[model samples]
Target: MAQVRNKQVLLKNYVTGFPKESDMEIVEGSITLKVPEGSSDVVLLKNLYLSCDPYMRILMYKDTPLSLGFQYSPGSPLTAFGVSKVVESGDPKYKKDDLVWGVTKWEEYSLVPSAKILFKIDHTDVPLSYYTGILGMPGMTAYGGFFELGCPKKGEKVFVSAASGAVGQLVGQFAKLTGCYVVGSAGSQEKNKLGFDEAFNYKEESNLDAALKRYFPEGIDIYFENVGGKTLDAVLLNMRSHGRIPVCGMISQYNLSQPEGVTNLANLIYKEIKMQGFIVSQFYPLYPKFLEFILPHIREGKIAYVEDIVEGLEGGPAALVSLFSGQNLGKKIVAIAPE
Candidate 1:
């Protein structure tokens, strides 16, 4: 195959405070449309959908703890969860045109080590872009963090922060499935359409603690913690005894140079709350289990996922920066190429 021009979104430098579009640039790079000779287990991918998530901001750091997983280097294309078609491959497990979802470069084409790919995407009945979100990493995160750690029971009150996001939206729906009362808070009140019993715009609330008390009068049994900082502090004060807090991504503090301190953490001791932070990789073993559980609900029209998609690689920078500014309404995705 011939070499082709690959448009890529590259990190210009390490971000300090809030990120702007200027922090990344779209550049034209070149790649052969085939796996390099003798490159065992290498797969050449035609990138399709790139996911814009809050955690990507963590990787943009010049100094990140090694335990945080991968980090982005200046002058290189960003890596993220994406849906792609295999253009060529040296691995027998994959072949030309095989649809897969995994960690792919933010470029039109990527030559990746097979290990980064989670699995081949088999079900094509639903939208392929979903692999970047509800059916992908975020889905796994919500399932493991909520079910595996949350341990919800019937008639319990559940609160999800940043509830309109990829993980939060699904977490709210999953809580409903478990027969729990679900209330969510976001910058906007769009979560009501996603099956949240009540949705509030946290931006409009002058006092978060008062807002939570109004909705969760009896106290929250399980708080799916997505936004940290002030939201977490308020939830701590409103928690029921022996409540569980599944610490998902803390979007509120992602772009902060110095993250705000949570003043009510002492409530964790008084309430005997169980709070645990998790990485999605710890739940990869549950992918098959997750698919089995979610796919049926999806096919039955019992669940919904919203995506805020931007077309082309040129829009990638703005789409990514939108995550921090709360500009994206749902799961933010960049369509790099046509399917």
Candidate 2:
């Protein structure tokens, strides 16, 4: 078998504080075209697209439990959700040329255990990169967190923090589809044009609590928690009675050594607010139903998704680091292959 040059983004060490592009190094590695003989339950992949998600930051910390037992070591390729084509497979459920999206290393090619694969890509009508964003994990996160946990009703007022992000954007749209009034908070106004009932730039707001009040005079019935810290503290004050808050990623607090404390727990009792944190994997069972609901809206132009894509494997480190600086305009993705 011929060996091919595999360009990889290697984690330099367990990260602390904010991550910088210098924390990762791009290096040339080599891999055989075929999976090692007799390696059962392994699949060789030609990685196409790699997703840059905020959850990945948690995985960079030493022995971070957020990784769910997957640990990163110095000089090892960083792991992320990606789209790939199967080059060889030892698993019965997959075969040569199968398209799949799931956990993959940040490299041109990867040999991964089959269990890490979330699902095989069956729908090709949309861009294959969609598997890394709107049609994949982020999509499912929004669906399960909002519809399942949020339990929002028609006419309810909903607020989404980091509303222009991959999952938050979808959550806001889903709220609108449910006949709810939705307002989103983003870092910039240019990135805030995602079909929400109203959107605000959190950076421009002198008081986030007042911003929420301006958007939801009646008070927020649902708050899709994305950015935590002060944003969450503000949302807590504006929550309506019987409100539901599905805690998603808290990007603002992810890199902090000391996470900010929320000061309004008493409001949860007084307002009877239901605030619950969720992991996307817990709701994988609802994926099929979510796809059925979202696909049509996508094809008909009823749904909109934004992606901030960087080209080539060499660009992975800077692209990943850009997330912390809010440099990427939308869902951050790296296109490793032409597809």
Candidate 3:
């Protein structure tokens, strides 16, 4: 194949609050499908779907460190996890037409430096797009954090805040599969219908603490904490003794210039609770184990997933900005091109 031109979404500048469409620009650039001469471990890929994660919104700040994830450098394209088809490879491990999932540039095409963290999509029987989300990062997060950290037991009562988001939805379903009673909180009533045994519209609730109490009259045994702050405080007051709280994300705190104060800390001591915060990257070694556990369930139709897909790179900026407003219904993804 010959080298070809590619379209890319470039970061126009650092951002604050919700990002605007003007913060990014789509431009065309050229790259060889063939690896450049002397390159030994590079893989060129055509991006199929780019994940629009909430974390990307935090990276729009120029001061956000590379350790958090790459900062979207000015004049350069943003990056994210995505599913792609390899068009060219300079590494012996990869070949043309291979389907893979890993970090990819937010553009029509990406040249991966090395396929180290990338994995091949062995289960083509499932949707290849699933690799971009439910079967990928979010899946791993739910499996590791909920099962491993939350340590849920059958019949235990579980609560998930931001329950309709990517990780929370899967966590709720996983709990149901374990015979646990599960309740979830979402911003709207429509999302409440998907999987939760009891779903409440957080926005409609007059008092968050009262709402949680109403759902878990016997108290919650485990909490998959996605939205922190007031939700966390409310959950704290309602936890059963020795209950587990796996702190996966605090999407509620991401946009605030300063974090909202929580007056309660004595509950952690009084209840003898186990509340731990974690980043999914810390659970990488368990990836293979997670795949082993989830693949069968997914294949058997025991698990379900939903996605909010935007048609092209042009919609990426607005779609990402919508995360703060709870505008996305499920896992948000950008279909850069056709499958």
User: Best lDDT goes to which candidate?
Assistant: 1
Pitting candidate 2 against candidate 3, the one with the higher lDDT is 2
lDDT of 1 by residue, 232-284 (tens): 99999999999999998788898888899989989999999999989988999
Span of 10 residues, lowest total lDDT, candidate 1: 62-71
lDDT of 2: 0.90
Candidate 3: residue 73 Cα off by (Å): 1.7
Using TM-score as the measure, name the better of candidate 1 and candidate 3: 1
Go through the candidates in order and give the C-alpha RMSD of each one to the true structure: 1.2, 1.1, 1.7
Work out candidate 1's RMSD over C-alphas. 1.2
Clash statistics: count for each candidate: 0, 0, 0
Candidates' C-alpha lDDT:
0.90, 0.90, 0.83
- Give candidate 3 regions above 4 Å deviation: 1-3, 65-69, 115-117
lDDT of 1 at 244: 100
For candidate 3, lDDT tens digit of each residue in 1-339? 565878888999888766788889989888767788888889888899888887787788778743644567889998888998888788878888888888889888888776533688877888878887788888888888998899989999999887778888899999998899999888856854555798888889889889988999999999999888898988899999999999888888877778788777788898899988887777767878878888898889888888888898889888887777864578888898888
Clash total of candidate 1 = 0
